[model samples]
Target: MNIDVLELTAELVKYESISRATNVPVTRHLAKVLRALGFKVEMLPYTDAAGVAKLTIVARLGRAEKGGLSLMSHDDVVPAGSADDWTGNPFQVREHGGKLYGRGACDMKGPLAASICAACRFTAGDLRQPLYIVVTSDEEINALGAREVVDRSKLFADLRHGYGVICEPTCLQVVHAHKGSLGLTITSKGRAAHTSSLKGVNANLKMIPFLNEMRKVNESVLTSRRYRNDEFKPPHSEWSIGINDNNVATNVSPAQSVCTVNYRPMPGTDTNALVRRTRKCASDLGLKCVVHRTGSPLYTPKDAPIVRTSLALAGRRTPTTVAYGTDGLAYSEQMKQLVVLGPGDIAQAHTVDEWIEVDQLHKGVELYTRFIDHVCVQGLA
Candidate 1:
């Protein structure tokens, strides 16, 4: 079963597995393919917050007791927006000028195809250890699929002391660290009434103080050395704030106002303290504060075995850090070593007419094949 990487990538992109919808279709297809390729496939199913049924596929080949290489990629992609934004159908692959264009072409499906093709090059009997392929859902939204795999999958449990690769778009460069994310929602409630009556409490009035405080916090994070990590570009934790009110008419007093804060935490930064401060401010203002989602930053030392091997495989001299988050945040603690290395550039991801160079896909297959040969077949750490 020598899978063509480009064809596999095209097949994957055709599935409409956007983060908000169920990824069962694509995942089930992948499960079938893996099973045909002589891998034991486990389907982990769960319902998302939207009440949509979702799934994660964990497939293993060879001796699955422990200590092998794990390749991770997410099946779901961010929405491609309007069809007018793309040259062709965003759900279909369009190859031109030595590039493949599609929604997840660069962000993930291409890399995922590369890994599956690489693993297919070897049989279970040829491996001294195991090769695990994890296709997760909702990674673009909350990484809940990865969290579920980490919490429940027995196959994932067997990855202890193993080397892992998160196939995120890094242009084949080796990434040792990436920032984490903390999402907070703050709410203010008040009585609603016509503005002319002046009889209702204004939720915005109550939220104004909190917004001012958040502005101060955001400015502080942007300028203070306390929130800085020199290893990443721009060096400071990004604190982003957004506000919304459901009131449709300006003549009516808003009954509720909502504020959302998304903070990126670095490896050495005190994220808990920042959360505490936010909660305290909300409490003092009589606002309800909720921690919606939290993802830890991935930090693998540059000297780690995975980093060294990945650098060599990718032909890079040194490991670098990224500001974006990945499923690596969920698996970092379980694996002995992990690195983010894959095809395409991050700049091409999530944009209109997203694409991966044809040359990148070819090189990706070669790179992943070498990596599988090194860590799984050759059993080298």
Candidate 2:
């Protein structure tokens, strides 16, 4: 059977590429498709040994030395919570009412299929700059796959001429800016002792007041008028306490406690300032807490050449900002101009019965074709 875009979507969904399992199968499958299209392919695997596995596929469709265009995407899909939540088997592809339903359908497999279809359609004589297909295994998990690809100096250096397109689902819209994220862990340490000793210090006791104080800090965030960017819904930084680990019997005083705080910072917000304030808050509570900066935020100018070209191809005059963050943060400094354009709505991603409109798939393939043609084939200014 021919590997058409829709058929490719079905094949990708058949493999349970959930983060908890191996994504090697899906990456290998995509590599096979790229290879059939006459692209040179390589495997860039990432493993932490403790069960975290990531893979990125790099394929070049012409002379490697020539300047090339790169299309990147992730193959991993977030786990489908509660099998009962889905109307059909989560792993099986189903079509209903003009939509294709399955895990990773919209969050990215659909776009990946469309991109590959566009590559197969392009004629040899039409090519100008080389076209590169980059498939990674862990974008759902903090863009781990893309991170590994960018870390390699040689990889980034070789394709520097190509304008990078992150084919993440955006319902065919072009996204230019996304917020940054910072995760902080707060820990409280104390001496453990028998409950009979009333004077014994219980780390749990210290945490109560501090936790209450942290609530105030979280509330303060909702009221702040700083870092305003009205383009995003409830535009401003958002703060929340992620995890609180304090479980102990009443007879014994617990020795340790931890609190994880996540902040989705708005554009231009001083992340350092927020981190410093959180550390001070912990100190005042008499708890020693260490704050670690998580990921960098991606910011691209609206007037950048690549952004202009992408928007023009999509027939839009302006770019949009999304609330979620992407690996774009990691490479923002080196690749200053970037955009996230793909098929599907972010709402369907990571949800049971995830799906992508068939029409979106068609539009995506055409968009990729036009984009590649304009940037790589025609080299239009």
Candidate 3:
């Protein structure tokens, strides 16, 4: 099969595989594409929290051996907030000034297309080892699909010593480290009644103390050197807090209020201690606390074989770190050598009229092909 990176990216962008919905359609399409390229495809299917069916695709070419190259990308993209904000349809790929404009064009689909095209460049007979391509779901919201790939995919299980690349937008730069994610949701419950009768307990009132404590924690995280990692730009763990009350009218007291907290953990940060601290606060306030998600940071040493090879392939002198997280967090558990490298700019992701440079797409294909050649075909690193 002859795969063109631009055309494949446009085809993938046509599928509205938003994080909230099922990614099965786009995943199946990719699976078909991989099969056409003589890849052995495996389907890992699961249901999301909303009871919607989702899928992750794992495809391999050449020998099913212990060591090779694995390229991973998420199939899900963030919601195209409003059509009115875009030049044309957000799902329709449009080329303007040598940039491909679409929802996942810069964020991931373009890099994903480049990976597919690179893998298709060689037939199975030409490979000394295997080449793995993984398409995961729910990367925009949570990394549940990547977790599933780590835990469930039999094909992935064979790549214990393999080199893995998370194809996230990095302008073709190599990333060796990124922050982790820890999320918490706290809920305060109360009885609902009319404010005129003054019989209802306001949930927001109960949540105020908790919020105040969280604010102090946030402040401390922002200022404390203990949570700082100088390798990243901001240096401190980014602590974010969000609040919501279900009541729509002032006449009625709110029956429930929710507070969501998100914290980014750097290397050496004690995430378990952070979770314990939040839980204790919620317990003292008699509020329900739930840990929604936790993902570890991807940390490969700059001298690691994968990082060095990826830096060489991208023509970079050193490996860098990013503030954002990727699926590497999950895959890193199994594959000790992993790096995040791909095309386009991270700034272009999740914005209105998102686009990726055509040159980046072509460069992405070239880089991935070099990586495959170095590892899978030539069996180097």
Indicate whether candidate 1 or candidate 2 has the larger lDDT: 1
Per-residue accuracy of model 3 over 78-128 as CA lDDT, tens digit each: 999999999999999999999999999998999999999999899999899
Instruction: Write down the lDDT of every candidate, Cα atoms only.
Output: 0.91, 0.78, 0.91
**Model 1 lDDT per residue over 68-96, tens place:** 98899999999999999789999999999
Instruction: State the TM-score for model 3.
Output: 0.98
Question: TM-score for each prediction?
Answer: 0.98, 0.91, 0.98
RMSD after CA superposition, every candidate: 1.0, 2.5, 1.1
With candidate 1 superimposed using the best TM-score fit, by how many Å does residue 367's alpha carbon deviate from the native?
A: 0.8
Residue-by-residue lDDT tens digits, candidate 2, 242-263: 6454546777777787887888
What is the Å distance of residue 379 in model 3 from its true position? 0.6
> Candidate 2 vs candidate 3: which has greater TM-score?
3
